[model samples]
Target chain A: MTKNILIAGFGGQGVLFTGKFIAYGALIEGKELSWLPSYGPEMRGGTCNCSVIVSDEPVGSPIVNEPDVLIAMNRPSLDKFEDAVVPGGDIYIDSSLVDREVRRTDVNVHYIPATRLSTERGFDGIANMILLGSVIKGSGVIKEETIPAAMSKVVSAKRQNLFDFNIRALALGAEVLE
Target chain B: MAEKVLMKGNEAIAEAAIAAGCRHYFGYPITPQTEIAAYMAKRMPKIGGVFLQAESEVSAVNMVIGAASAGVRVMTSSSSPGISLKSEGLSYMAGCDLPALIVNVQRGGPGLGGIQPSQSDYFQATRGGGHGDYHMLVLAPNSVQEMAQLTIQGFALAEKYRMPCMLLADGTMGQMMEPVELPDSAPEMAEKPWALTGTGLSRKHNIINSLSLTPDELERWNIDRYARYAKVEADEVMYEEYLTEDADVCVVGYGIAARVARNAVNAARAKGIKAGMFRPITLWPFPKAALNKLATTCRAFISVELSMGQLIEDVELAIRCSRPVTLCNRTGGMIPSPEQVLASIEEAAAKLN
Candidate 1:
C-alpha cells in the first residue's frame, strides 16, 4: 500500500514537523518513505507545505503532484490543494483556521476545530498534531500506536516536556472523529 | 549492519563525510544546501574538527585548496551560483592535482535564478566547470541513501585518483529525507607523499603549485592528467539498467529525474509497453559503453531531464545516433510528472510499432 500525503500551513505552524512525525512513523514500521518540503521563499511566514510518501515498495518521485491525503491547516492551503486530491481521497482541515468550505465533493472532507480545540485543551500551538491525529484516524495512513515512538524521534530532548500535551491533543483530535 | 536513521540528504552528506574522515569543511551558505554547513557547524567542534564558514564562495574554495594541500580530507558545498563563483579555485585544485570533495546542490540556472531544484548544470559539471582541460569525478545520487553513500565514495575516489571529485546533486536531493544506513567505521586514508608538509633537515620539502612556465613541460603535464582521466573513464563508469533486457523504449536520466522516470517506466509496463530506464551514477564518465550496448536492442530512447534538453545531447552521442532519440523534459526548476513521461514512452512505442 502507498499513500501520498501533503500537509500545508503557515511557516511557523509546524507543517514540516507534522509531516516528519508521519514519515518517522512510517520508517519505524519498516516502510519505505520519502519526505520533501517546499523550501522556497514561502518558508518565511508564507504558505509552506510538505510531501510525505509511505509505500510498501521503494518510493519513486518524492514530489507529490496528486495527493491521496491532504491536511490543509489554513484557508489558502485548502483553496490551493483542494482540487489536487484524488477521487475518494481524504482531506482533513483545521476548521478554526480555515473558514471556507471545501469546494470538491468527490473526496472525503473531515473538518476538525483543531486550533480552538487545542486552545481549549491547553495546547494552543499544536493544531498541526491535532490534524495529524485526525488524518491518522480517518485515513489509516499510519497506525495510531506508532505516534508515541514517532513523536519521541521528532521532538528533541530539550522539548521532552511537551510530550504529554501533544499526546493529549492527539487523543482529543482523534475523539473528534468518533 | 547499522541501524537506519531518517535524515535529510544534506545532513546525510555531512554525517557521511564525517564518518569518512573528512574533518575540515569550508563552505559558504546558499539556498537548498545550507543544511550541510549547519550540520557540520553543529557536529564538527564536538568532534575536534574544523568547520569554517568563509566570507564568500571564492574564499571557501581557496580554504579548501589550502586544507587539501595539507593532505587532509576536505569538502565544500554550494548551490549553482555559488559554485560558479568557486570555478577558478576548482581549476587551480584540478591543476595542482589535489584531492577534495566539492558538492553542487544545483538550483535554477543563468544569473541569480530562482531557488528551486534544477539539473541545468549538467554541461557545466561534465564539461569541467572552469578554465582547464580536466574532469572531476561527478557522482549523481538520486536518493538520500546514495547521498550518504556517494559522499563516502567520492572522498575515497578523489584520494585514489589524486584529483578533486564532485557530488552533482540538485535541490530536491538536498531537501528530501529518507532512511539511510551510514557506515560506523572510519574509512582508510591514503598516504599523500606529495602533500605540502614541511620537511625537517632529514628530507626535501614538498611544494604544491599549478604554475608551469615552459610550454613543453605544461604540455606533458596536460598529457599526464588526461592519461589519468582516461584511466578513470575506463574504470569508473557506473550506471544502473532496470528492465532494459527486453525493452523497446529506453529512457535515460540521472539524479531525481531518474526517479520520476522509474515510475513512468513502471506505468508504461503496466500498459503493455516495453519501457526501461538507464541511470548514470557517475555523470562525468557518461556510461557510454553500457548505453551503446543498450542502443543495439532498444529501438528508441527518451532523454528525461529537469533541463530543456542538455542530457539529450549526451544520450545521442553515447548511442552513436544508432537509435532514434527524443527529448522528454521540463526546465527552469520544474520537473516532468510521471504521466508526461509515460506519454512520451507511449509516443516512442507507437513509432517503433
Candidate 2:
C-alpha cells in the first residue's frame, strides 16, 4: 500500500531532512516515491514542511489532502496538521513542546520528546532524525537498512560528523515505540 | 565538430546559443533558470561576447533589441512574470522585424510566483505573447536534451524570419540534468547587410524602428513579416506522436508536462486502455496540422497542464473542436502525476461511452 507522510516543523530544525531520510528508506525498499517541499517565502523561519509518498504504484498528488501519517516536530505543526490525519491513521508529535493531549481518538498519537532527546544525546540539531526514527518505528513502512544511506547523501561535505549523531538518534527513537 | 555533454536545460541553452554564434545576452537573475545566466556570465566574456545582467526584464529585452539592431546575434531570458514585463519590447521587436531570441523558463502565476516548474504560459506564448497581430516562433522542449538543441533552432528561426523567437520552457526543464549532443559545424552568423551599422560611403543607412508614419508602409511591413511567419508554420511544425496510431485517447502537452503525460499513457495502456501522447515541440506554429490528423483517429484528448486550461484552447482550435478535450492539472508549482492524468483520461473515456 502507498503511504502518505507529512513532516512539519520550524525551518532549520531538520524537518525536511528527516522526511528525506524516510523517502530514501522507501526508495531503498524498492518503492516508487516522490518528495515535495512546501514553497513559501518563510521557508527559513516559519513552519517548514515536506510531503512524501511511498507507493507500490505511481504516486498521485504529492500534496496530501489527508495524510496517512503526520510527523510534527513542534507545537504549531501538531496543531496545524492534527486534523489532516486520515481516519484510523497516525500522528507523531514532539510532546515536550506540545503539552496538550491530542483530542482525536480516531487515530494513534505517539508523542516523543524528539528535540529534547536529541539535546540529551548531545546532538543539538538531530531532532529531525529522532522524529524520522519514530515514524519508522510507528509506521514500519520502510526498511531499517536504508536510513543511513539516505542520511549520508544529504549531509554536506563540511558536516560529515552528523551521520553518527543522526543514526544514533534514529536508533534510540525507533527503540522507544518497540 | 559539435560535442555531447550532460547539462541542465538552462546551461544547455546558454551553450547552444553560444555555439550558434549568438554573442549578446541580457537577463535578470531568477531561480531554477539562474544557471543560464550564471553560465553566460562565466563564459561569454572569454569568448569575446556580451553578457549583461540588466536591471530588470524590461531593460533586458530592450537591451537585446538594441544589440540586434546593431547586427549582432543576441538573446535574453526570464520567467513568466519577467516575460510579462518584456511583452512591450517583444511587440516592438515584432513590429520592426528584429531578429533575436527570448527564453522564458516559465514559472507559475500572474505575479511573482514561486520559482518552480510550470507550463502555464501557453496563451502568452502562442497568442502573440507580446502584442498586436504578431506571433513569436515559440519552441517548447520536453527534455534537457531538446533544451540545448532548440535554443540553436530558435536563433536560426528568428534570423530566418527577421523576428524574435521565444524558447518557452519551464523551471523543471530549466533545472533538470540530462545528456545532450552539441551541433557539429558551428553556424557562421548570417550577415545583416541592412543592419544599423553606420553606412559606409557606398551604402544607404537602414533605420530599424517599429513606428512607421504612413499607414501603407506599416501595412506593407506587417504583410511581409506575416508571410515569413506563414513559411515558418509550413516548414517548422515539430511534434512527437508516441503510440498514437490506434489510440483511444490522446494526451496533448509540452515540456515537463509531456513527460508526465508519457508516463500516464504507459500506465493507461497497461490497464488495457489504448492511450498515447502528442507532445508538441513547438508551442506557436504549434504543430497544429499534426494534432488535427491525430484527432481523426484518437477518441478524445486530455490536455495535462500545471495551471488552468491554456493549451486546451489551441488543441480545440487545431482540430476545429471536433472531439472532446479535457484538462488534468496542478497549480502553484504542483505537477500532476501520471495517475492523475490517467484518471482524467478514464473520465473522458467514460463520457464517450
Best by DockQ: 1
Cα lDDT tens digits, model 1, B289-349, are 9999999899999999988889999999999999999999988888899999999999999
lDDT of each: 0.93, 0.81
| Model 2 lDDT at residue A105 | 94
TM-score per candidate, chains pooled: 0.98, 0.72
Complex DockQ per candidate: 0.89, 0.07
Local accuracy of candidate 2 as per-residue lDDT tens digits, B163-243: 889999887677644446787645557768868888777777798888888999888888887888889899989999988
lDDT (C-alpha) at residue A66 in model 2 = 70
lDDT of 1 at A110: 95
Q: What lDDT is reached at residue B85 by model 1?
A: 98
- Candidate 2 colliding pairs: B2-B184
User: For each of the candidates, what fraction of the native contacts does it recover?
Assistant: 0.82, 0.00
Error of 2 at B264 (Å): 4.7
Top candidate on TM-score is 1
**Cα lDDT for residue B338, candidate 1:** 97
